[model samples]
Target: MSRLVDAHCHLDFSVFAADRAGVFERAREAGVESFLVPGTTRARWPDVVAMGAREDVAVCLGLHPCFMDAHDDLGDIAALSEWLDRHPEVVAIGECGLDARFADSWHAQWSLLEAQLRLARARRLPLVLHCVHANDVLARRLRQLAPPAGGLIHGFAGSPEQAMAFYRLGFVLGLGGATTYPRAQRLRRTVAALPDDGYVLETDSPDMPLAGHQGERNEPARVAEVCRIVAELREQTESRVAADSTATACRLFALD
Candidate 1:
């Protein structure tokens, strides 16, 4: 079996509430040996941390931009910094970034993102960004900060030119089920053009399901299907994509 990793997921979400254990077991059987769960809220940080304690799970802590309305206090950023200081299991700082698509207040979103970026830099940990239709703003901020340690752009659907900008800023493009859809022409093209060394594989489970399973909830086990599609697009074998992506993820998170 080709060893693989699901670089980003939200196992704490209620989608896996009934049989989370079974979901993980099925993922392992599919050759997804490790999973990274990123926290999106202060209250969920403990649950996220607990999930990471499981044999093959790793965790990242940060407030997601979608929940900007929820983070009224910037103190949560400090709390996360303290948490990172104490917890060795916490691998990175994010699932946080600017999302101008759904929210009305870009200032609040940018504030939260900038604070988290500072925390990640101070802690010397990588970031797990969640950018949505704001890659230009994201790229600009990343350039200004130039964090010594880099991170991954989860669920990237930008153009090849935009992707190259991120690559120049030392970020990895996280590819997932979005590229599997025949209708996602631009995304497919971007994924096809990405360099093997500049990408990582993810499922973003309970969210971006593969083409055939579009309406169904996604699971970590389906990452292999994603790899197969990516490999086909890149004109490479599944084993090669799986091995290279897993290595890229390991290096990003400093996994042993």
Candidate 2:
């Protein structure tokens, strides 16, 4: 089978710090040769950049809403801009978006998201967005902006229509561990029905472990399982899912 991209992960995070190199090796052997590690806060950008420097890893720079306190001032935008300008290796503009499911500061989250969204558009980079319980606003903003560089809505768990909203606006859904759950009929159905190019496989590694691996640390290698599940849901073969999802991610991130 052709190699696949673990479209979203946090290998730089402490969870994999002890054996980061080993983690990549295992993933590579599992047929996941490329990885996209997105920044979650200013403090971790350096580590993320260092990881991105590797031949097989790509990175995205942005502040996630769950860590709203990390982006105190709008200064993060300036810093991210400078970093992105200096680092052609940076592939996308996010890991940023609203997290109404967990964060109490929804307004602050939206404000921060807007700043990054504008930066992403200005730089002509697709965004690696993370939205939880806030698709209405996310879709609305994207409609207004119409960014030329499309992106992935990572860890997608929405309906077919909701998934189509992003697809129509040049964004594709990221399918991950959630699809492995038997109870995730809705999400699985969405992945199965969406246009073949409208979704990509992600592990969201060091988090979102598959159903059987619950309570364990997720790694890029597990994305292969995600691909399998997506294939099963779509009633297609594993190889087909791998090739299609990889091509879609390559286009969105300019990973040529």
Candidate 3:
């Protein structure tokens, strides 16, 4: 089988602190060779960057829209820019975007998201964006802001049309545990119809567990199952799906 890449997983999060090494070991054992871990807040950037020391780990730093409390009105964005400058090896700028769940902070989310978008644009880095209940709004924002280095829309469960909108904007969808569920018809259809370069496999570790593993902490190792289901959805061989998705991830994140 071709090696797989978990394009989005929070291995740096505290949930994996006790056995992070074991997590990586199992992932590699399961044929997952690389991971992209995105930082969700200023407080976590150090841990996120530190994970990059591992040969198989790549990092992206940005203040997530869900954690506005962890961000400052001025310093965080500037600090993120400086951090990226200091850590030139950092792969992208995000884990950032709008979330409707935090609607009260909607404007603030847009402010922070736009700031990160600008940073990614200025640096010519790809972004690992997160959007919830705002694809139309986000598509509009991307069109207007025009950040050129397309990124992944992590944990994408949007419609096929929505997926294509992001693809047209240079972004690819991160298909994760959600696709493993039989009831996720919309996402499955999106997966089936995705352009050759339109999507990548992800686990969103410790959060989006696969169908049979509900309530279990997800890990990078589970991405192999994601690949399996994706292959089934696309009516392609598992190795083909794994190879194509891994290649797309390498190209998107500039991984070696």
TM-score per candidate = 0.97, 0.98, 0.99
Collision count of model 1: 0
lDDT tens readout by residue for model 1, 1-256:
5699999989989879999989989998899999999999998998999897787889999998888767754689778878887788898898898787876778888888899898888778899999999998899999999877899999999999999899888899999989889899898888888888889999898998888896898999999998999999999999999998999999999886
Best by lDDT: 3
Q: Report the poorest 10 consecutive residues by lDDT, candidate 3.
A: 65-74
lDDT score of residue 146 within candidate 3: 83
Off by over 4 Å in 1: none
* Ranked by TM-score, top first: 3, 2, 1
Task: Report the alpha-carbon TM-score of model 1 versus the true structure.
Answer: 0.97
Candidate 2 regions exceeding 4 Å error are none
- Cα lDDT of model 2 by residue, 1-256, tens digit: 7779999999899988789889988998899988999999999999999998788889999999889777864788889989998998899988898888865788888888888888888889999999898888899999998988989999999999899999999999999999999999899789888998998899998999999998999999999888888888899999999999999999888886
- Residue 190 local lDDT, model 1: 89
